[model samples]
Target: MVLLVPIIGGVVALGLLVWCCVCRRKRSSDDEPTRPPDTSSLDTAAKSLGFLETLLTDDRVLIRRRFDIRDIQFERPLSKGAFGEVWLCTDRQNTMLAVKKLLQHKNDAYKEIKDFIAEIQLTASLDHPHIIRFLGVAWTSMDNLCMALEYLPTGDLLAFLRQNADMLTWVKDKLPMALGVAHALEYLHNRPTPIIHRDVKAKNVLLTEQLQTKLIDFGISRDRTQETMTAGVGTPYWSAPEVLEGNRYTEKSDIYSFGVLLSEIDSAATPYKDVRSPETGEPLRVWQIVSMIVGGSLRPTFSDACPQRIARVAKACLDGDPNVRPSANEVIEMLLGRAVSDQNW
Candidate 1:
């Protein structure tokens, strides 16, 4: 009986220590301090590296618009962000495309511009049904970056949920959608030089009319062969624990972010709710997500319209441990909403 009291005290002490560490991490943005991390040197250290071939393939791979881009007009603005806008464009070839027009940064260095070009090149190199296809790219004047891609008319998953879908339809919809997304992510993650879609969230995942999920927006994606990101490189919501902790890059981290994304999908909303966070008394950094779920601070209960089985999968995906979080392939199988062949992931 006396030994129990000391053990209880030790547990309380451990909890306090954890609180202090979390508080310290929040109070000081110390984690983001590393910068200008000699990417050249870092690249040398990578266990495996993606061929810069996509970027190096040169001017021949780039197809300049034959018809005046002005002549082949876009039907509507598909989306807008800090980097210019996206439009639904139709070429004289009658190919429907989603064009991303990037705003030129006058002060941007040559290397920075090349990096953006690299992203476009990477997209163009892949031709997968689950991946958003890169049709072509053009530098309209040096400053602006533009990419022509296969147009997806059905929009993203969040938009579908907002339409007031019923439970049965929601399950039917999410499962296949998740499977497609899993295929895309697994293909990226399993490469010799694995590509971490550093940003994996509802919005970046696009759905086609056929319901196949296509991964878009690799602006912040990283080659996992490298040790770590150069500090400030990910969208806050789907950022992983190690990313927040400023640890080295690992494929497991993407799995962590995927968990958040999966949870958000079931909840029918973006992962981070912009509400005041109880932990730091400020907006939550991404890793606070684990605490939020464990502490019951954030609830991802699916809407009444969502299926019960789908909701369970969402919760499982959000499991705090990245090791336990299922792979994108596993996610695909689950989305089929069939019996999981093995409970051990």
Candidate 2:
């Protein structure tokens, strides 16, 4: 009887231990984050070699710029957007490159393909120190239609500023970055066709190891010659009032965005982040802020530490009337402490 009791107790304890382990595993499984669906096969199907060949053959410039994928090796991903992703890659000579790939599983539509081709062409044609350099385009199949560009090791301006907030200063860090972007904007605005960078925020600006700025991401840029330029298609915080109101996007709109960027440099935060309701003391909702901006009653705030000269330029850029905004050249001259001649707008 004594031996039987010990054996029975051991069995009951074993059962309890099993139940506890099973319960723990259940809890763990519930707590685990849900993994994104694996779309590798879909990505492969989208990069069909036949489709890539067809698209390349249609464009003469693309035909000449065809890159042999065999010479390139894939590295880790750097960033991602709605339609595609940018990857860090290396060439046969071990040169580092940023490769932007357009990955869509659906059948190739004419408009989408044309826009992508135009973006590649525009990027390749640009030649400026402040602009991101284009290397070439490559593809194994349609899913991998990729553009190779110069890789800046220091990353985008927004992240760099946030990460190095404590160490950065106005003259040494901020001024140069602002100047580089201004130069880039001036170049774009003075182009033969006068390009309008639809999006001109800090995230679109990249930095070098030396902290020099390089303006990038021309996915939505358009020549001033294009008809119907009223699409409200940029980030909300950096967008000009006219752009937010679905009015025509002019070079002046870019100037307004530049002004917002100046404030970003001063605060190291998103535009209008400090704005709050007087009654509730809570941050204003996005829609409320947008309404106030379009109504001309609100503008991005500058920190007290911001230099008076820079603050003045920022205010001029954020003027309610687009006609009152300073030109990119004027902004540059202002920053340089040179006299800016009055322009009859």
Candidate 3:
């Protein structure tokens, strides 16, 4: 009776184990059909880089400009931004260049790749002295996707203006800088298919060793025909009222930014920096300033030191009516006339 009882217990234990194993197998089989496929092999860095290379090859304009990653020699980082960094690099020929490299982990990899390609396409198609020169693009992996450009040691226009405020004469320095920017805008606006530089601020204007201005950063600039009625682009202080209101972007919007830039040049300060609230006597907040600007109740203030002719042109640019704002060519003419008169004086 004792041996029989032990045998019965062992048989029950084996039966329970078998049942559990069968249930587990059934559950696993049911889940297997719903499980995501293994995409790890397909989504690798090599595949992404390969895809980018294929896209670039398809672009006739870009195919000729592709630089092998081995040819570029990294020197040091010049600047860092949200999604990428600019490095001061050199080519095989020892020619110095600025290379903007994409940081893939910061954003959706596909979107970043597409935007980088778009920038490359637009920059390579452009040929102008007042615009930043696109040297070429290079990449070994997705993380190393890079755009090479001509290096400007003098830094951006805003920093240059502030640094040389005491030494820079209006005719020799400020006027020429403004004119160069105006010329760049004129070139962009008059393109066979016009381009609206949605973001035009002092920081985007880079200075050469000779302090000549070159318009840089076309990531936001769009062909006017392709532009929708999108708003909320550009630096607030430099943006036009129409742009703030989500109205269609036009060349006049750039003129408004140029007007704000004039204020910047004159005071060597950001637009509306001196503005204070009538009630609190404190500097107005960005929202308040934006509201006032959109309402056409506020325009950027000029310094007392600002020349009257420049102020006049800036005021015309900042006019509440978009129709009333001067075209880029008209602005150029007005400035040129003033420049000639100053030279005569």
lDDT per residue as tens, model 2, 61-173: 76687789878898999999877789999998999999988767464332345457668888988999999998888876554678999999999988888998889889888
User: How accurate locally is residue 45 in candidate 1, as Cα lDDT from 0 to 100?
Assistant: 25
Candidate order by TM-score, decreasing, is 3, 2, 1
Model 3 TM-score relative to the real fold: 0.82
Off by over 4 Å in 1: 1-76, 109-112, 227-231, 272-316, 334-345
After superposition, candidate 3 runs with Cα above 4 Å error: 1-52, 227-229, 338-345
**Candidate no. 2 TM-score:** 0.81
TM-score comparison, 1 vs 3, better candidate: 3
Q: In angstroms, what RMSD does candidate 1 have relative to the true structure?
A: 8.5
lDDT by residue (tens digit), candidate 3, 13-33: 332233344435533442243
lDDT comparison, 1 vs 3, better candidate: 3
> Candidate 1, residues 1-345: lDDT per residue as tens digits?
000011222222332334446445543342233213334564642311223223334445554421235534678898986655789988887778898776554332333455566677677666678889877765434344577888888888777655644452544666677667778888998777788877777788888877778888887677765443433355544555445444444666676666666655666667556544444457544444433433333434455655666656565565555677677667666666665564753
Of 2 and 3, the candidate ranking higher by TM-score? 3
